[model samples]
Target chain A: MRLLEALALTITNGSKPVCRNQNFHLQAGEIWGVLGPNGIGKTSLLHTLAGLRKPLSGQITLMDKPLASYDRKQLATQLGIVFQDSQDTFPSTVLETVLMGRHPYLSEWAWESVEDISLCMTALEQVALATLAQRQVNTLSGGERRRLALAILLVQNPSICLLDEPTNHLDLHHQMVLLELIVQKTLRNNGGVVMVLQDVNLVPRFCTHVLLMHNADSWISGPVADVMTTTNLQLLYQHSIRKLVDNGVTLFYPE
Target chain B: MPVFSPAVPVLSGRYFLVLFFVALFAALSFVVALGLGSADISFNDIVAVLTGTSDSLNQQIILQIRLPRVQTGMCVGGMLAMAGCLMQILLRNPLAEPYVLGVSGGAAVFALLAIVSGLSGLWINGSAFAGALLSIFLVFVLSRIGNDWNPLRILLTGVVISAGWSAFISFLLAVSPPDQLHGMLFWLMGDLSYVQSSFWNPIVLAVVLLPSLVYARSMNLLATGDLNAAALGVNVTRLQYFIYFASSLLTATAVMQGGSIGFIGLVVPHLVRILFGSDHRILLPVSVMLGGSLLVIADGLARSLIAPEQLPVGVLTAMLGVPLFLVLLQTILFRQRT
Candidate 1:
């Protein structure tokens, strides 16, 4: 099933156009990575795809309907976005924060049922945060907070997931665990995942397809094997690259 | 079959227990406030009047004088605190309160106009409400100039509008006759003693609170930030409108009842958050209860502090709330540093 499709999309910041003439299609059972240099409209493209930003000149359809046609509630049940960071000004417990994901399913003034609570609990356990569910979110560290964000999205159970910098702050162990969890969950549900990442190695390892944004009005996107070549990556990053092929895996790094 | 272990869930039993105590405290404060006048009505006398066994002078004082006053206090206090909670959530700023958006200043300006023109009772209330609604509309329109409903823009607009309202208020005061100054000052300082009937206050309180309670869950999502709420499927724009309208009406009603009572709105929610968690489902109700109780006690003190003379209830709320607010700020600063 087609999860999201963009046609001739153009995004702008103020009067200046940031990206132009973009076309992409995301389908179920696919993991796509969006990569670019800093300030190259990567976040803007991610946000535009997630319906957080409107394209300057094109149409976006989600779940076979126009993105603008769906109301907030309808859109929320099908699509979820995990932000890079979240602020915790008010002191709500981790459990309470995670349970907020059930909001789209439940009616107003209805309490969380046993099923909702259990789902949130399972998501917390998946993120290794079940024990800290009683603690305040304000007391969490940067990595733990990111895990909690993932946990919230897990509990939300959206068909399509949009994540920006999903591994920005994490230890080596957690980075692998979170990426695997996201890929596993999306594949299980037959949904697509879109991620904005900076790491070069993670893209070749996990992403089924890759979109490399160079500057405004320019981009290259294709299957990971076709797009993530040593020459292409070196040109995209404007740097000298060293490539190594060990068995079936390929690694690209700047020399 | 060898062993059975019950899983201890994370759910705690303290919520209901704490709620019960808060209600009990409000009830206790209500009963205590009834007997705290210069006429010296005893606890037994209040009970006798309630049970229909007494018809003495003290009964008249309790029923005619103190009962309506206390009821108004509770309603006004609850309304202010509830409005404050909504404002804080809408702006995502801890220091945001009811009057931070100039609702009270607008009310005070129009209310002073009515008072100076010798308008009595409902006319004053009507004008104050109209003025408050005007301020709400002005702030809403001005803040949406070239962007979406940005909290910083809204807040900055409200603060500037508040400054404008204060200047208007000063001009009104400067031109008013000397004889009406006492009445104007009393009204501006917030006097619960002037509350005659308790019908509209309770009705407005219920109308605003019941609907707002239904949206408590959304408010919880909003406290995190706009993006989080939006991505989670909440209609952030619609929710912001609901909050602004509800909070403005609540503040207008409170100002109409008791002339812009301060600090109860600003302080009560923080106090409730400190005690209970920040879930609005719990914080909203507890804030209303505690706000009502605190105002009743403050009014009691205001009435009894100089027996035979009364002080504006706002004075006591500020005196009591300022110190508590200072302590809260200090604690917040202390936490940020570490």
Candidate 2:
């Protein structure tokens, strides 16, 4: 089933329509990457697709229903989003923070069951944060905080995951591990994953599909094999590009 | 993964333990406060009066004066603290208190007007409530810039409106008759002596707190960030409205009862957060118990410290809470540094 479908979607910055008449769709077993320069509405487009912001003129359907039709909790059961930046103004333990992902599934005022706690613990373990379950979130390092956010998204266990810059502050080891984890989960469940990424090289390696937004209004999107060629890369990023193909791996460098 | 996991659940056991201990402490504080007033009532007499086995001077003093005063303190303190917690969550601002959003100031303005106009009894309470609701509505409308419930804007509007209310309050006080000045000043400074004997305050506290407690999970999510809460499926806009109106109701009720007891509302939630962590599931109830108990104890000291020349409960709350708050702040800073 198509997990997300956008038709003629035009997202705007205030009254000025930035990305106009854009069409995209994501089905199960596909991992899509969104790439764009800074201030080009990539975050806004991700937000609009996740039903957090309204599209200027478009129709978006999630799970075959209009996006606006699904209520917040109902939509949350199917779609989970990990924000690029999260702040903890108040102190809550890591376990407590991860357990909040179970909120959409639980009834109001209901206590989390043992199963919920176990799921959270398992996600924490997956992110190597089980040892810090009782530690305060504010006390965590930047990479740990990012992993904690990913752990929260994992616990939500949604059918479609939307991540804005899933890796921003992680070391190379954590970056590879986290992306591998996300890909593993999506492939295992035959679920869809859409992420906004700044690392263009990472896209050709990991993404099954790619959407390159150009300045806001124009771009190209298709299977990664077609959309990630040298000419398309130059047009989307507006830079001279050097492509190196070695041992079935492709690398892009600006000249 | 080698950490030894306790058999008890993470949230439930510690929550109940805190609730049980604070409840016990509140009961103990209530009894001690009942015994400390000027009319020398022994513990035995208090017990007898409580058990309904005595009807004399001691029983009269306990039933008529001390009991009513303690009850008022509990309701006012609990509601104020609860309001403060809601405001802190709603604005995502640690320094938010019930009065920080202009609730108490608005209530004070209307209440002072009532006093100056020779109004007493329910008339004062009615207008104070009106003023409170008005301030809440004004802040709500003013802060709704482009359908965005910007926390900073709401905070700024409330603070500015409160400043406006303060000006009006000062103007009222400046022109009042000398005889009415004392009563108006007492009201402004938060005196519980004016609370009439009634069971309504406690009942109202329960009515408001029940709904607020149900939103504990949402409040915890909200404390993280609005985007985080919305992404987690909490209807952030609707929840913000729920918290704002519910907290305004609580603040109006508390201000009507105790004339804006200041320190408990501002400091108790932080103290509770520091001790119990920031989970509202545990923080909310603990704050109520601690806030109520602290105010009752403060009121007791206020009544007895000068021997019939009672001090305003607000003055006592600040005198007591400021030093503890400073110590807690220092400890937090020290922990952060180390």
Candidate 3:
């Protein structure tokens, strides 16, 4: 829709540009990976898209209308986001944390419906955390908390999923577990998954399209096969690239 | 092991919660409070007074003075405790008490202002409510200056403002006209002796504020902490403003009647949290009951222990409440750590 469209959407902190006037199309059913180095504008771009932060200039169109036209409540139901640092240090139980995702669906006086409870259970099951529903987030290990956070977003069931650094602090096992679940659910339902990821390796495995953010201003986005190259990876990181062919993953290290 | 049923688990609801033992206990305490003291009446006599069979001077005292005072105290204590609980939640700081964020002190200043200005006691409530709102507005404006508002910075600003107002109150007493000194001192010390049959407005506020907080559980979840709640799709800004207004109203209404009942707000919610866990479903209502009974019991001792000479109920609450809070915090922390 024209409303959700972003034409030259830019953000900056004083003189430095975070996301330089970028244009992108977000459609349902496609999982888009946001790849970048540290201090780049990937998180900023995600925040602007999520409406958590405002843009300096330009426009965002949704449903052939301006994104700002929809109120926070209206936008929330259609857009679910799982932010970076899913580290919930509170003693809230896994079930309680997951049930919070149902906030947009329920009213002030309404308790969780039978439908809400079952949806929460199914979301946990998708993240393979059905058994740990009663445990506290503070008691869980790093990887477990990451998966539980993913379970929260899944339960929300928004049309567009914006996840920032979802794979950070996760073990290889959970990294694959979360990415596979996102692809399976979004692809099947024809929903959109726009996530910021650190590991360039996982991008090829899960993402159909990738946006590479180098510095704050530059991005080269297209098919994963196009964006993940020795030259682009080296340039993005300002480093010498070493490729491992059999593993289907490339490593970048500073010279 | 036998398989647990796949059906939804049926936890206890309003049968045990709404209008049951909790309410029953509070009602019993209210009756017991009315019957206690020098003119101790039998339950039969108390019943007779209510039934209009007894018209003795003792019956008159029981009906006219003691009943309203005791009932009003219970309502006042409940409002103070719940207000404090919600304020702490809204601020998301464990150390938050009723006046810690300057809302109550701001109310106290306006309340004191109304009293010194020769306004009626009821007018004090309106002034106090407005003052609390204004202070919050000021603090909100101050904290947002030149950057995104930081909660810790706001907390510090509140402390400074509270101390400033408190000192101003002492200054009022020190330099005031001799005739007005006695009343100002009473208000500052927080006496429950002014209770009369006409004083039910605070109860209305308590009833309304209590149900509103209960009905809005999503607000409680957001007030627990901001970022976690926001990622789950809570409109945090709107919720913050609502809680700010609601919590301020609660504190202002409470201070109107309760006269700075210390520690009920701080200790009662902390007790509720420890007993049933941090979920506000159990916390808000339990704090109301426990706080009322605890204050009634404290006031009973305050009046009966030294008889004719009245000790301000605020001192009693602070002395009794603070130690118990320390012990409870230590125990909970020890358990969590181990």
Candidate 4:
């Protein structure tokens, strides 16, 4: 099933259009990685896809319906996005922060039920933040905060997950563990995952497909084996790249 | 995977305990305020007067003067605190208060005009309320000049208008006669000596608080950021407007009742947040209760501190709140370090 489709999409960063006339369909049970160098509009593209930003010129549909047709609450049920960074204007507990995921599912005057709390706790444990449920969010480390954001997205349980730099600030072990967890969870629920990643080597291992944003009005996306080549990556980053195979696993490195 | 249970019970227990203490403090302050006036009525006399068993001058004192004054103090304090809480969330600034948006400045200008015109009682209050409404309208309109309603824009607009009102207030003060100057100064300093018992203040408080409590959860999400709250399923635009109007109404009503009393609105919410967590479900009501009680006590001090020459309650609140908040912060920091 198609979870998200962008037709004739043109995303911009408020001053200049970044990617133009892009077309992509994210299907259920597939994880797509968006790779780009610095200053590229990867975050803007993800924001546009999540309906947080207006596409410069394009159409986005979720579950075969126009994205703009649904109200915020309804859209949240079908899609969730983990921003690059979370803001803490006021102090709140870790559990309280995670419980916000259930906001869309719950009514205006309702409190979180036991099942909701259970789901949040399970998500926290999956993210290795179960012990810090009572700790204040402002006291968390950057990596811990990132895990907390992922936990919130997990608890949201939307069909389409749009993550901007999901592995940002995470150590190598947590990066691998959490990404694997997100992929496994998405596949288990037959959901679609699109995450912008900084690590080039992580794509071949976690993403089933790749969307390489070269520059404004230029891009290529296909299965990882098809689009993730030395030439394509070199062109994407405007640098030299070398591809190597170790024990039948493919990896790319900058030369 | 390991299974874990949420800390709901612990949090709920803390909520109940904090609420219970704040409510008790409010009740105690009410009783103490009624008994500690110039006439010095005893606790038993207050109870007797309340129960309609005492027919002495104490009855008249407690029933006629102190009762209305205490009630007014409670209403104004609760309204201001609730307004301040909403303003902080709306502007996403901890320093935001009921008067930060020029409501009080407009009120001060108009109330001074009324005093300069030799108006008393209801006329001054009516003019102040009108001025507050005018301020609200101006800020709302000016902030949306380019159809932008961001917090920074709204805040800047309010501050500018407030400055304009301040200049007008200075002009009014400069030309007023010496006799009317006393009343004008009292108004600016937030005197509550002449407030009468009316149902409107409580009604307004209930009206504003009900919706605020109902939307408290959304407010928690909103305090993060607009995009964050919207992505979390909160109707950010609708909620923002609701906060804007609701807090303005709260500030307007509070200024009308008590001449734009300060400190309670600004400090009470922070005090409550420091004691309890920032969960609005608990924060809103507790702040109201604590604010009402603190103002009631402050008003009592204002009345009896000089025994006959009553000081402005706002002065007392600021004097009291500054030390209290500082000590509380220091103790909390010390505890954390230990």
Candidate 5:
């Protein structure tokens, strides 16, 4: 099933188009990694996809309906996004922060039910943050806060997950663990996952497809094996790149 | 897999228990304030007057004089505290208070003008209320010029307007005659001496309280940030407008009643948050109760402190709230550290 489709999408950063005339279809159980260089509007594209900002031009459809047709609450039920960073402007418990995932499902003036809380706890456990559920969110370390954000997305349980730099601030072990968990959960629920990633090597291991944003009005995308060649990566980053194979696993690095 | 339990009870029995105690304290403060006037009426007489059994001069004193004053204080205090709580959430700043938006300043400027023009009674309150509405309108229009209702923009606009009002207030004070100075100063300091018991106070409280309680959960989500709240499925623009209008109305009503009683709005919410957590479901109602009770007690002290020479209730609230808040903060911090 097609979970998300972008037709001739033009994403922008206020005035200028970041990427123009992009077309893509995200299907169930497919994890698409958006790879780009620094300051290339990856986050802006993600924000546009999540309906948090207006795309410069073009249309986005979620679940075969126009994205603009859905109100914020309705959109939240069908899609979720984990921002690159979260700001802690007020004091709140870790559990309370994660339980905000249930916000769209709850009616006005209703409190979280037992099942809602159980889901939050399970998500926290998945992120290794169950023990800190009662701790204040402001006191958390950078990596811990990142995990908390992931936990919130997990609890939201949307069919289409749009993550901006999901591996940011995580250590090596946690980076692998969390990416695997997200892929497994998406496959289990037959959902689609699109994550903006900084690590080039992570894309081949975890993503079935990759969207390489070369520059404004230029792009390439296909299965990881086809589009993740050293030549394509070198063109994408405007640098020389080399490829190697170790124990049948493909890897690319800057030469 | 490990079994998991809730870290904190979202809306549990303990919160209700705390609310019950705060309500009980408010009731006790009301009774105590009713009984502690120049002519010391006994507790029995106070209860008798309240229950419609007493018919003496004591009954007249209780019904005619103290009841209205205490009732006005409670209503004004509750309104201010709730406004403060809303402002804090609306601005997403812990330092926000009801008057931070210049509502009270506008009210004060017009109130001082009314006093200088030889106006008394409802004239001062009416002008003050009009001034407050004007300020609310000004902030609302100015902050929304670009249709960007961001918190920082709203806060900056309010602060600048408040500064302008202060200049006008100083100019008025500078020009007013000596004979009117006493009343002008008293009004500026937030005196409740002349406030009569009106049905509008309770009515306004109910009108504001119900809608705010309904939106309390959205308030929690909003405190994170506007975009984050939007991502969490809240209608950010609508909620911001609601908070701006509701809190402004609350401040206007409070200023009309008691001349912008300070500290209660700013301190009472913090007091409640320190005792309870920052859950708006509990924070809003609890802040109202505590604020009302504290103001009633402060008004009682203001009345009896000099026995016929009443200090402005605002003065007493600052004097009382500062030390109490500091002590609570110190205790909580020490406990957390240990």
Candidate 6:
């Protein structure tokens, strides 16, 4: 129902260009995985798409119009973005933090209405943080905080979500939880998720599409079955991969 | 399980402490100050003179001159401290204050130019306010260079503006008649003796700074950093610009009216923060009240410390305020470290 397109995108930070002649499109109803080495500009690309960053060249369009045309707050209503690092200044409770999603709709001084509080709690309920609503943001455990971050975005009610690293600071179980929640939100809204990931095997499981960036070069990207082969994984990472069948699931990891 | 009272709030509990001590100390200063001078008046007589309206000059001394000056000290002192607190919170820096941040220096330069250029009385206050505004405006512009908008720009610009103004004030001092030079220097260092009741206008004008800062209950969000604030949909650019203009307007108004009250802006906010923490709602009002009381005490000491010789009130404020300020700064840093 919705299409987000990056048209002939180029990103440069003064000297040499970082990304050049790149294009990607996301149609609603599936998650797209971005796989890349450390300097491959995965985060930068996500930032540009979210309108949090300005690109050196090229344009992005949603629903056939230029991306810049969407007012940032309005775009926020349709697209939620999760940043990589947590900040130090926010001292509001989890409930207050999540309710900030209603910022674009409320006047500068209006109190959060019952509807706003309900929406925020609903996001907390989705993330299994309903009990943590009164807890200070700084007091949350790393895994819990990441969950809260997602909850805040969920309250934003965006149709298309962009996550730089949904699992960056998470332990294994929390990582699984975050991935599950993202998948659930996308499926419920018939929305798309474009996520940056380094773990290659994760792409085949929850991600419907995968894009790999290696040594400053853009590589294979397509449906998981076509792009997530052992040879392609090895070429993109410059490492070997071993696939093992455990129970019924196919697991791929570097040997 | 610690249910923090939303009303009393942790911040108020802490800030009320600094507020109380400064208030009590100012009250003591008022009583002691009324008992001295070349024509020594008994403390009891001063109180009696204050309550009953006698047509005598001695009674007039208690009512019109002494009482208003003391009241003026209390009001102006509070206004300066309030201005300092607002500036610090607006900039989101603990080190930000009105006097040292070039708001006063800029205003002082303008007021000086107006005074020597044949402007006198009320005209001096307006010129000073305009000067302070211009200086702070310039500093704000310089700091926001390339739109990077760092605190360092404001700090550096303030220092440069102060140096330039200091040079200009010195040049004016060099050419003025010898009798007037002492008066000019006294004004530069900041004194509270010319305590006119009409100075209340600037105080009223500064009321806007209070709400501009208080409304940002979201300012606590800023402590998280600009990127985080932006991600939260904080109109970051707009907030930054608004704070800069508001703090400048407030600081300029105080500097124009109060010659140069010292240490209240810098030290009071620091003390309040150490006692209360960094919430603006608590910090702002506490700073205002404490600032008033502190100046009352300082002005009292300036008048009464010597039998007949009156000292500059700024001298006394720095004398009392600096040592306490150092102790607070040291205690805060040490506690924060380990």
**Model 2 misplacement above 4 A:** B1-9, B329-338
Global CA lDDT computed for model 2:
0.86
- Estimate, for each residue in B295-321, the C-alpha lDDT of model 4 and write its tens digit: 989999999999888999999999999
Whichever of 4 and 5 has more DockQ, that candidate is: 5
Real A-B contacts recovered, model 5: 0.64
Chain A (alone) TM-scores for all candidate structures? 0.97, 0.97, 0.90, 0.98, 0.97, 0.92
lDDT of 4 by residue, A1-255 (tens): 989999999877768778889898999988999999987888888888988878878889999999999999999988999999998987777998999998999887777887888999999999999999977788899999999999999999888899999888999999999999988988888899999999999999999999999877788999998999999999998889998999988988888
Tens digit of per-residue lDDT, candidate 3, span A147-253 = 87788788877778888888878888878877888778777766788888877777777888898887656678888777788789888777787666566555543
Instruction: Please list the residue runs of candidate 6 whose C-alpha ends up more than 4 Å from where it truly belongs after superposition.
Output: A62-67, A70-72, A89-102, A113-148, A154-157, A214-220, A238-245, A248-252, B1-91, B99-101, B108-127, B144-147, B151-189, B199-207, B210-218, B266-338
By TM-score, the better pick of 2 and 3 is 2
Model 1: what is its DockQ?
A: 0.54
TM-score of each prediction: 0.93, 0.96, 0.87, 0.96, 0.96, 0.75
Clashing pairs in 5: none
Q: Once model 3 is optimally superposed onto the true structure by TM-score, how far is the C-alpha of residue A127 displaced, in angstroms? A: 3.4
- How do the candidates rank by DockQ, highest first? 2, 5, 4, 1, 3, 6
Better of 1 and 6 by lDDT: 1
Q: CAPRI verdict on model 2?
A: medium
What are the per-residue Cα lDDT tens digits for candidate 1 across A1-255? 899999898999777676788888999998999888777777778788878878888989997889999877778889989998889887777888899898899888677777888999899999999998876688889999999999999989898999999997888899999999989999999999999998988898889999988767778899998988877777778889888889977887788
lDDT of 6: 0.71
Question: Distance (Å) between predicted and true CA of A121, model 3?
Answer: 2.8
- Which pairs of residues collide in model 6? A89-B223, A89-B224, B78-B292, B107-B132
Error at A148, model 2, angstroms: 0.5
Q: Relative to the unseen true structure, what is the C-alpha lDDT of residue A115 in candidate 4, on a scale of 0 to 100?
A: 88
Of the true interface contacts, each candidate retains a share of 0.67, 0.62, 0.22, 0.65, 0.64, 0.19
